[model samples]
Target: MELNLKRQIGIFCVLLILPALCSAAFTKSRATFYSTSDGLGTPTGRCGYGDYGRTVHGGSVAGVSNLWRDGVGCGLCYQVRCTNPSLCNSNGAYLVVTDYGAGDRTDFIMSPAAFSSLGVNSTANDELRKLGTVDIEYQRISCSYPGQNIVIKIKESSTNPGYLSIVLFNVGGTCDVIAIQLSQSGSNTWVSLQRVDGAVFQISNPPSGTLRFRFQVNCGSGLEWRLPKNDIPANWRAGATYDTGIQF
Candidate 1:
């Protein structure tokens, strides 16, 4: 009876241990943010854990500002209001949140035609409009990075004060990097499927693609790690404020 009980107990242990190890091994899909200053990890949100479906877009085009603010084609889109009272004016418009925009400052893409619709074409108005740069304001992601040992840089993020963006990271070397639309490439309407932090992104290919890690952000902005890819200046320096590492 004692021997039989020991065998049964041993079987149970194997069942429990195997699944746990599997979870840990397979969990590499998630990203953990590590601090560059300290060796601590911050909490990266989970996948699909954010609202990319924000309702407001397009700041109301008016005055000389409207000449550049609402040029034309404004509907079912996004909005970028001026922080300065003298610039954006007192109204808002609806714009089609087109592809990736500027960067961490303004978080929307208002077509030039859209900016022209509001009337008033003055150089001062153009200057005022230029003050606001587009950025990613919403979305969430689990962060991870290679080395689980290196620290990542932190930055300010989010389009709205109430919500935060998303991000992910991974440890080790990266894989084949494919270039896509992180922002609007002139007249080209390239859309970004994901929001990224401006700090840096880390991807891992373990045992030669046996395992892949792509660190992502869940916030509303695109990441601009290098100057060459700084399509949107606003998205170049935004990210999660946490440390990353292996917990085990």
Candidate 2:
């Protein structure tokens, strides 16, 4: 009877500890900041994204090395907080993956403006200069938090009605896009779209007129949105790409 009672006590202890372990989310990483000194002649990133400093949360840009998977890392968001409790904010600072780094480092490279906003010490002479690098904890968050979402741009070939090209932007979240489908307006039929590359997809002999898209995320869910004929941009021209900021 005593042995059974001791076993029950052990099981109870395990249950008590499991929840704490499961709730721990942040991952440890090193972070540093960069600016014009970094010699980024062109502010635009490999992913074709730029103007990050002008985001709602000023200076929200960050760079990662090859681990960024080329342009695939673009538009992903993260919450970063200094490991030093004294310098950290209760809510941490939000960062967007806007560019890639040249060197191979596990560190998160933030824009100088982003680093300054992290609650780090900023003296009158130098803002965030004293705190050159810091140990931080970070976790990936959905881009939707910033009112950003996946965008699709269509490029039709005037000579070949059977060929269609599409570019995807602002791809981020818990899941990557696994598949895409399109349905002609007023039709119940759905047709598959084929991936041409990491950021492009294609469909041959697509139906004309207004259409809707269904994007299947790897997380076992899908997002659907539509574009009306009237909503098509006035500058849209065959064989010329036009960005349609359709979210989700």
Candidate 3:
């Protein structure tokens, strides 16, 4: 009977240790995400943060129904998975996550259905007024800029896929969609300035705050993206660059 008691104690001890071992293993197993080393996400827009080419899901790209919100069209959002899943309702209107915000949480934001319509991802069309935003609290903050005759260059990485807001400014005030141009080797290519009627352009970066802009080139797939300004800011970042991606 004592031997049996000892055996039972040994079994209990093993069971107790199993949970600890499993928990330790889980803690050690790190999820490979593309971002800064600090783990605090980008203060502003920065490119080459995540591997867009990689399959977010099992052997497939995580399809998002929408990205940007505001002044968008009305439609039913599809494929876009909600971190909360319930954040989206039956109505066509939902906040589309354009670029990843600077925060650490993974949330799916909705929009005024109108904002959803104009985006390239929008599909269904309905009454514009009915599709207005439901959740107004979750707004994205990122670096906005619009480039012009000023000579500049950005290097893109495989993780960058042009998901940012471009603005323009100097000592003067800044404007939205005022002007922007994307080129290859200082020459117009793929999406030349002439081809893109507007001044603003789309880029990949974090939301909120001022980021000293670092031009990203050929991010992984030979595309352009943005990176944190390794340098200091010239101004308080009074304004932003043009947003060409704001499809009229």
Candidate 4:
């Protein structure tokens, strides 16, 4: 009976540890860098983040091809490390996916800053850049931005009271925002917003009133719905940002 009890306890411990181990597992891939004079991401990248993409994560950003998932992969974070012991650091770079790109048989086309972060020092970094491409391993990681909540940005293309286009910003956590629905205040009917571009969602003929939003997110473990504490004003304007007052 004691032996059986010990076995059960051991199994329970393994179950607890397994998830952490799995989360840390890195998959092998190839990575290359894009040219930006300042080693930063492009404001005009495919994600539609604009100037925010240029400085997000302090410019440690990447463009992923296969992982794009029809724009769902935008804003996802990953920890990437190069395998070359002589030229690369083990800790690697932590980057946000802000664009879509594909390289010669590569999964990640990182920003110059992100690619250089894999090196141990300036000398190594220079050599790595000269190589132009390298073997890398990467794993998805949760994103966190200190002192920032989820922000909804009204795209400049939106037309008042008829069309609404918005983007999600500072979307932390390891979840993918799969869907968003907007409803008029105190109304049971919810209108689903469609993904029009990377990180951009839109709806036409939106209900005319104060609007509240709910997001459906999947964090690999499971799918969950998140509701924001704030509501969009009836007279929402283009080029404005609304703080959700919450994080994923």
Candidate 5:
């Protein structure tokens, strides 16, 4: 009886420890900063997102290189804090991966604005010149924290009924959309959507009916949105398309 009680205590202790382990998913790395014209054009990045101003979570933006998994890293958010305690903020800044760079051996490349926003310096250029680079820690965070989520829209191609154009918008949190799938009405099976570019997915010969979309985010989470059957245009004709606005 004593042995069983001890085993139960051990199991309870292990369960108590698990949440801490799950929360500490951070990595240590070096970081640098860049500005808009630092000889790098307004990069559309691998994730195919346009340049927004710095100041994510009220902090500046970060440009990561080696971490860029094509465009998969585009819309994900990260919490970055300087390793140098004196240079770091009590609350590290939040940043989104909007661009990529030719990463140095370091782990992150911050936009000039992002670096300055971290209280590293008054200006990104000044921080770049003063620090050149710095040590930092980063970890992935959920997209829902920002109260935004991925939005998918579908449009019929003007030229072909077999080709459907899908676009993503208001991509908050997950960083980038890696995989997309569609389900036709009356079918439990899901069909994969092909990437035509950063912003577009193509479904060839899509069925005529209501469809559902599933987006696999870069952070290993999945989001789903469905369009009701009646929402689909009747007799989907060639060159005809419909747009389903933002969905969860």
Candidate 6:
């Protein structure tokens, strides 16, 4: 009996520490920066964020390679800092994943502003820029968007009744939307939507009435389904945005 009790206690302690260890873990990788005239990321990014890509995390955005996870990694946030003591700062920069790219042995392709932010000073920043790519460590972090709820942007490619497409914006949280399903209002049958591009979901022959959305999210904790407070109107038009009134 004593041995069994001791083993149970040990297992409980391990469970308590595991979550913290997972959250604090960092990945070592190589990173490079892309240059734009305004020191910002491109609006026409691969993630389909459009002009909003230039504004997320105050223009501190990055294009990621394997981390893209086939577009499911879009809208995720990361805290990145270079390992170079001579040219880098300890604080580093927080960036949002807005595009998809890979460099020579690199995981993150950051914007100029985000890359420069890794430096200790202006002189250090200039030198770091010259290096083009640097050794770095990064960890996933929660995304925060103050006073902004997750909004669904209707893609221009969508047509009424025939096909529907959408991009989720302001997906603030530590979670990733791994899967999405939709159901017509007042119905119990749900239809799964396909992830076509980074941050883009589409389906053919959608239900006719107002639509409800549920997302499967993984946030270090197990995956959970998140329901939005609002539903897409029956007359939803292309290029119109619907406020889900929920974050994360």
lDDT string, candidate 3, 1-248, tens digits: 00122232235346663232222121111001223333222223211212211211111111122232221111111222211223332222222122232212222322232223222332322222243322221211111112312212221221222244332211011111222334332232323222111112344433223233433332124545443323222222312222222211
In model 5, which regions exceed 4 Å deviation?
1-25, 37-43, 51-59, 120-125, 145-149, 153-160, 165-167, 170-178, 196-200, 216-248
Candidate 1 per-residue lDDT, tens place, 106-125, comes to 33334443343222335634
Candidates in order, TM-scores: namely 0.22, 0.58, 0.19, 0.90, 0.63, 0.89
Between candidates 2 and 3, which one is better according to TM-score?
Answer: 2
Candidate 1 regions exceeding 4 Å error are 1-76, 116-124, 129-248
TM-score of 3: 0.19
lDDT of 4 at 133: 90
Q: What is the C-alpha lDDT of each candidate?
A: 0.26, 0.55, 0.24, 0.84, 0.54, 0.84
The stretch of ten residues in a row with the least summed lDDT in candidate 1 is: 27-36
- Please write out the lDDT profile of model 2 over residues 1-248, one tens digit for every residue: 00122232234347763232224478887777776654232245554443332342344667776437644565566677777666665455666666676433445787765566567455421533466777777765555423434555564433244666665655654455666777766677989887654445678777666666666655324553344232333333454543345443
What's the CA error at residue 142 for candidate 4, in Å? 0.8
Q: Write the per-residue lDDT of candidate 4 for residues 1-248, one digit (tens) a residue.
A: 00122232235346763254245578999999999989899998777899888889778889999889999989877778999999999789888889999889888999998888999999999999999999999876667676678899999999989999999988746578999999999998988999988999999999888999999998667888889999999999999999999876
Question: What lDDT is reached at residue 149 by model 4?
Answer: 86
What is the clash count for each candidate, in the order shown?
A: 89, 0, 64, 0, 8, 0
TM-score of 1: 0.22
* Tens digit of per-residue lDDT, candidate 6, span 1-248: 00122232234347773344235467899999998999988998888999889877668899999999999889877779899898899768788899999889999999997898999999999998888899999976556665678899999999998999999998736578998999999899999999998999999999998999999998777999999999999999999999998986
**For model 3, what is the error of residue 23's alpha carbon versus the real structure, in angstroms, after optimal superposition?**
46
